[model samples]
Target: MKLFKSNEWQRVKKSKAMVIALAVIALIPSLYAVIFLSSLWDTYGHVSNLPVAVVNQDQTATVNGKTENLGQNLTTSLVNGQDWKFTQVSEKTARSGLKSGKYYMTVTIPSDFTKSSGTLLGKSPKTPTIDIQQNGGRSFFAEKITDAAAEKLKNKVSQSLQKVYLENLLKGTKTSQDGFTKAAKGVSQLGTALGKVQTGAGQLQTGTMTLQTGATTLSNGLLQYTGAMGKLTNGSANLVTGNTQLAASLQKIGTGISQGQAANAANISKLNAGFDKVNQGLQQLSQMQVTIDQSQLNSSAASVSSGLSSVDQNVTAVLADPTVQEKMKTDPAFAQQVSDLKSNLTATEKSSQDLKTSSAALNTAVMQQISGLKTQLTTLSTQAITLNNSAKTAIQQLNDSLSQVANVLATQAAPGATNLAQGATTLTNGLGQLNGQSQTLNGGATALSTGTSQLVAAENQLTMALQATQNGSDQLAQSLANGAVKLSVVHTGTKNVQALTNPVKNKSTSLSTIANNGTGMAPYMMSVGLFVGMISFSTAFDFITLGKKPKSGMHWWAEKQTVMATVWSAQAVIMTGLLVLVDSMAPKHILMTFVVALVTAFAFNQFVTMVIVALGKMGSALLLVFMVLQLSASAGTYPIELSNSFFQVIHPFMPMTYSVDAFRQVISIGGLAINDLLVLLALGLVSMVLTWLMYHRKLQADTVLFPKTAEK
Candidate 1:
């Protein structure tokens, strides 16, 4: 084993080509790790260097009286973003650049972008669209990166637009608040007016009730006056009849005087007796006339007329009342009642006037007739006494006096009584008409009273409703005022709007954080480097050439392992140091990172050595194939699950997969994975055992085939 190890170095030192090859081989893994990891160290970080065209075809628009240029704003934000190298250009230039691969992607703001954004406040709002055209043929990763950039741009534009929309909405809210404040004030005034109306309604109800009472009293008085007029009519008829009887008696007396003056000295006694009967009749007629004169019908009629006038005045006043007039306009039933009452009162007033005039005329005529009759009856009585005392002396004088009395009675008393009776009848007829209307009047008054009571009830209900309405109006006004005040308290500034637009902020807390893409990729790239380095070492060094014959296959395996371990250890140290010092990879545990690197390198070297030792020169090609397979199978670039089914199926079998996992645990924020180290150690041990077995089998085969070389 010692001889084989010494000869291996002697062969490498003797050949200048081998010495240079060994030196190059020692750096292969470091070079591969640095080159590959550096290329993608911060791939996304440098995405800003990729050219992206921004076409600003959008025009400005007005949103709630404010000019908005969302397209221009988006362009400015995109230019400032770290996602892509955004350049503002025309649509034609952007398209040209996109087609010619001058730009990796093109972002186009549509002409109606701002216009569509302004529609958010409208009933049928339209969603604004941004056109992102990517040249997928340029580079798959570049296309994907630009796609992500486009998504970020879309989100940024959405946020900015949401902020603008919120600002406009807040402005509209402020205007609405002001309008509500004014409306509340108006409602407050309306409530106040409703209160006044309620008070006026109460007053109207009171007046209506009072008018009803007066109407009832006037109706009752009219009925009483009508009865009084009927009695006066009867008395007037009696006066007419008495006047006729007296006129006939006076005529008979006048004829008796003319006949008795011619024939009676013997009939003087009988003439005296007849004169006594005439005197008794005259006295009864005088008393009847006095009674008629004392009736005072004119006064009662004037009183009734006055009452009617009062009722008319009261009704006029009620109709003139503004509240009643207004109610009359609205209530057809009440209006009709009032109109009927007014017409009836007007007719009743005319009847009362006519009755008053007739009563005065009848009273005067009866008084004149009574005075004449009393005078004529007293004269006749005195003449009858004188004729009785001196029958022959003054019978002709007495007869002449009686004739004068009869003539006065016939001419004045009878005609006056007849005229009074006629006047009384007319008055009674008028009163009867008035009395006939009295029931109607009483009914109307009662109806008016009922209607007034109903009106009062309705007014009470209306007042209650108005009061409730006023209260509701007050509450509404108060609520609106409060709402306006609350709205006023809301802020709608740029900062507030921005906060409202993006209400939730992402606060991520990474459990295992890697500094950069390079750091994250360190484990995979380093695993790949170690495997490639092992393959390169296997190709450069002579694995099958032995300087001396070995006693056992174990000795042969030990000799190769010692040489490869030295070289692989050197490669691991150099690669790990460069990853730290040159590449600035900050692993969580630097020592653990180095240990994982050494273990990974050793595992790869053992695997390569196993393949080379077992397959000879063909094993080098197979080692390359093995490395290629492991590269794909290892969860290096992406998770093994993200890879194809072949890779996922082979993932657990690949030694590099564990190596990468161990490296990642040490390189990032976690402790080194014990399972990964054990798996890697187990794979290396297995490869070493397999290689030993292969060497043992080959030695036995050589010994059987060429016993002399085996013995040497």
Candidate 2:
């Protein structure tokens, strides 16, 4: 170990290349470890304690019906730092705060939030609709924290709704209990009320039945009473006539009796007068009795003998006349019997006269009533007929209006039918046109395809014909060459004899022809020789590393440095050559070209070597970064300021990036001259110095970091 260490230190100190290689290798792993796994907090430091603003527009809903506003219950109950932080502000303020970056994001609970409480059985309810406005783009940790808070707010709202739902259900149990008690009380009261009501209803029904029967009986009685009044009226006419006859007879007989007494002629006249008077008085008395007809009046048709009160009395006492009185006076037994008969007749006649007076008054009242009822009934009947006619006329007018409306509707239907027919025809024509167009298009496409095929075949045939023509031309030229050779020999033989005239001219002419041919052939051979030289250069480049020992870090380092220098130098030449070759071979400043090439190559080598050193031979993936970032990107062809951001980012680090810019400068300035080379050189030099330092650090490590897990 001691001898090996001495030799290794001697070899390292003797070679600048070995020291650099060992140093770079030793530092690389530590840099990676320090970069990747240094701190847990730094990775997540940007996300902690992000601030957000939550504005709740809804005020808490009152338990009672009256209050300032219905609030967001969740917002009201939200525990700050636990559920959410509520920053009280107007919507504009919240928005302003978020925009000014005082807060990362702003959330607002909307109105109409009670709907969030509604849910299925035992499930958590959803949160109310809320607006979460983010000021910055979503990439920031502030936005992420805002999102986390919003989700927590949603979950807490659901939890609150769950609590409220359960509370409501629990309250319902008490409500149900109260409801059951009230229902039971109501049921008992209803039963008692129903029983009383049933009793009352039964009583009412019985009373109604009784009243119906009474009404029927009263109706029959009213009808009978009407008929009795009519009968009384009819009987009054007959009684009137009888009374009138009695009155006339009483008047005549009274006058005749007076004449008979004056002349002392006959007692029969007095008797007749007295008998008629008695009859008339009896008729008057009959009016007082309660017969079915009371319309027969005593005063209305009574025959009163045209005498005073005494005469009426006398007539009443006609049954007690003197002849009867004398007979009663002559015999006691006979007189007693006659007096009793007279008393009985007098009472009966008096009773009949009183009844006649009452009947007259009643009949007058009944007739008046009957006349009023008949008038009312006739008026009602006329009104009913008039109402019937009016109703029929109104019905006829209504029917006429309805018929007119129906006719109008039926007549207007023709336009709709015509429109429908036109629409159908238009639709059919459109469909037909579409089908025709489709067919035409299909045929056109097929013809286009055929044309394309013919065109392709024609082009192929033309190519083959041109190729065959070229081959035939080559053959013709060869045959012409052989013919020329033979002609030359024959001409030389022929000119040998004519040497005196033409030998000197032919010699000069042949020398000129030979010189021109040599000039043409010389260019072709030189081109081939240059190509062969390019191949040899490539072969030398491939095997150059074989001359150096792998064990000697200096050999490896020197090879790498030489390779880097040559690559940069060659890249500069080729880049300039490419410009000269592909384009006008424009004037270039070779110094500026070399400087740009060196800067670009150094930067590129560092980056490429970094990748290769990191991934070994598998660093082919780095080419993807090159092609996409350099060639396809504007960093190679145009100014980075004109390119997109991604191109601008890597432009300073890419070789073509500086090469392209320097190429433009060299071409524009007309020579190998540029002051901007300082900036480019500084970037490359700084990057190279850092890379060298990194390599020096890597040399201190005992072993390679990758693919060498075992220490031994």
Candidate 3:
């Protein structure tokens, strides 16, 4: 204490510029630090909701209001005081309006909405439903807002349905309104009448089919019989023609045989005449022979005898001579002489012999020929007789056959004609009976198969119509029930949507205690400015501006910080705990309040030390510069925005900015800026190093080191 008193007090008493500069420099960083911790007011914990539009398509009621009544009424009741806003619009505009970015989502009711609405409880109702669509995914907060609104609408519609159903149930209809019931009864009666008609039509159809079948079968049989009869008639005609032709051929053959027999008999007569002529010729020849014999009886006989002798002699001579063995060769002249004479005798003898031989051979040949001719004639005669007999027999047989055929034809034709007449009569009677039945069949079957099919269609259509009526009535009753439920259940919850509000100010004088303490930390920025100025002042006084070294107060102040620490530490600890004791604390964390104050003090101290080390002995003049330039711009009390660029340059590097952030976290939120704790600890370690190097060097040659400080 005494060393500090003597060294520090003596230096300060002597160095006037050092004293003035020290005062100014020390004020800058301290003041800067004071202003910094002040600002940082709002941004705490506040959550919000979205706005929605509702559209109604129901047109059952009449109203003159601007908003669609059904949707507006429903939204107002369900969403009041909750964190949501609901508005009503027409169905046509609602969907497009939702896409228009003004609202988060939209709900729309469809037309035929009551019919749609009535389906919640009805049998076989494909209900009319509301559309609650959102642009955002269901996971988004906006979708939650939309869903909340949608649920409200669902409840409303459900209530409406219940209400309608209850009213209908309470007020029952006097008559049965079931359309199917009445339709069924009517169908039953109509079906009974149609049943009789169906049976009658069936019978008529069966009878008509039978008659047609029988007529076709009979017609086919008749045609076959007619063809058979035609073939039989042709065969009979061919047989009669064949018989006549056979008779003609037989007559012709008989005539030819008769002519042949007659010719053969004529030829035999001619032969007998020829034989008679031959006998006469024989007689004349004999007579001629006798006469000739008488005429040349002696001469001719003698010459012939003589010539015969000569011829016999010559013949003997010729026979004896080997060369002339023939008689003619030796007696040619003699032969010539006796030739005439011997010729006549020879001619007569030859004639007689020839006649005798010829007669004998002729008798034999004639006898044989006559016998063969007689046999041929007899055969021809027999053949002619047989031909005549055959012709007669054939004619007789043909006549008999023709008579029999005629009788058989008459017999067969009579029965056929009788039967044909009877058949025609029976057919006429049967056709008459058939005609009667056909008339009965045609009586009632107005049409046939198609008529029955049309009747079945009518029955089916009747059934469908009846079912539809029952369904409609049930739906109307169900609609009443749904409406009642929505009305009763929707009156309970508050609206869940609201608007964003203005940001709050942080201050020591603020109505909010936590907010005020946060404001108290603002002085630390000015303190930080002062802390910088003090370093300049302390360094300049002891180092640069001081002329004397041994007894200068600057030199004393540099070495004995324990005294300063005593004062600063006391100031810091007291200032830090000051707000906690003074006010009814905000319902925030107590640890946060202590933390704000502690960081503010720590930052202020670190800045002082850093400047004190950086400025050294000449820090007095530099301190004066730092005070005017940096302190005014420190933004401790007011913003440093008005200060020059040089001041702005160094403002962020100052510890006050971060210290202020830490303070804000504590006061505004309810905790410390634990994330920035590292920076503060780092600043503390660095300040010690700067002090050791700069202060020790300044202490060695205070006057020489800061020459200008010695001059001043």
Q: Best-fitting candidate, measured by TM-score?
A: 1
The global C-alpha lDDT for each of the candidates, from Candidate 1 onward, is 0.66, 0.40, 0.42
Candidate 1, position 581, lDDT: 87
**How much does each candidate deviate from the true structure in C-alpha RMSD?**
22.2, 55.2, 54.2
**TM-score for all predictions?**
0.68, 0.27, 0.30
- For candidate 3, write residues 522-565 as lDDT tens digits: 44442443344445334444322333343443353354453344
- Give model 1's TM-score versus the native structure: 0.68
Return the clash pairs for model 1, or none.
Answer: none
Residues 1-712, candidate 2: write the lDDT tens digits. 3432432244335568655554443333222222222322132343334556667766344321234332444445542444334566778888888877777777787764544323222134344577778865644655656677678766656444444433443343333333323323332332343344335334433433432343233234333323433432343344334443533343343343344334422332332333343234223322322122222222212321111122224323432333334445656875564454345334433433433343344345434433443353344334323432333343234334334323433444333334333433443443344334334333433332343343334334433433443343233233323322322322223233333122134333222221122222221221122222222222223211223233433443444555444444444445434433433233345455445545554554555544444454454455445545555343433346887787777766554444455544554434442544555566556545554544444444424342222212
Residues forming the 10-long window of minimal summed lDDT in candidate 1:
289-298
**Clash count list over all predictions:** 0, 29, 78
Q: Which candidate is the best by lDDT?
A: 1
Regions of candidate 1 where Cα sits further than 4 Å from its true position: 1-5, 11-14, 67-69, 76-83, 233-490, 703-712
Q: Which ranking of candidates, highest TM-score first?
A: 1, 3, 2
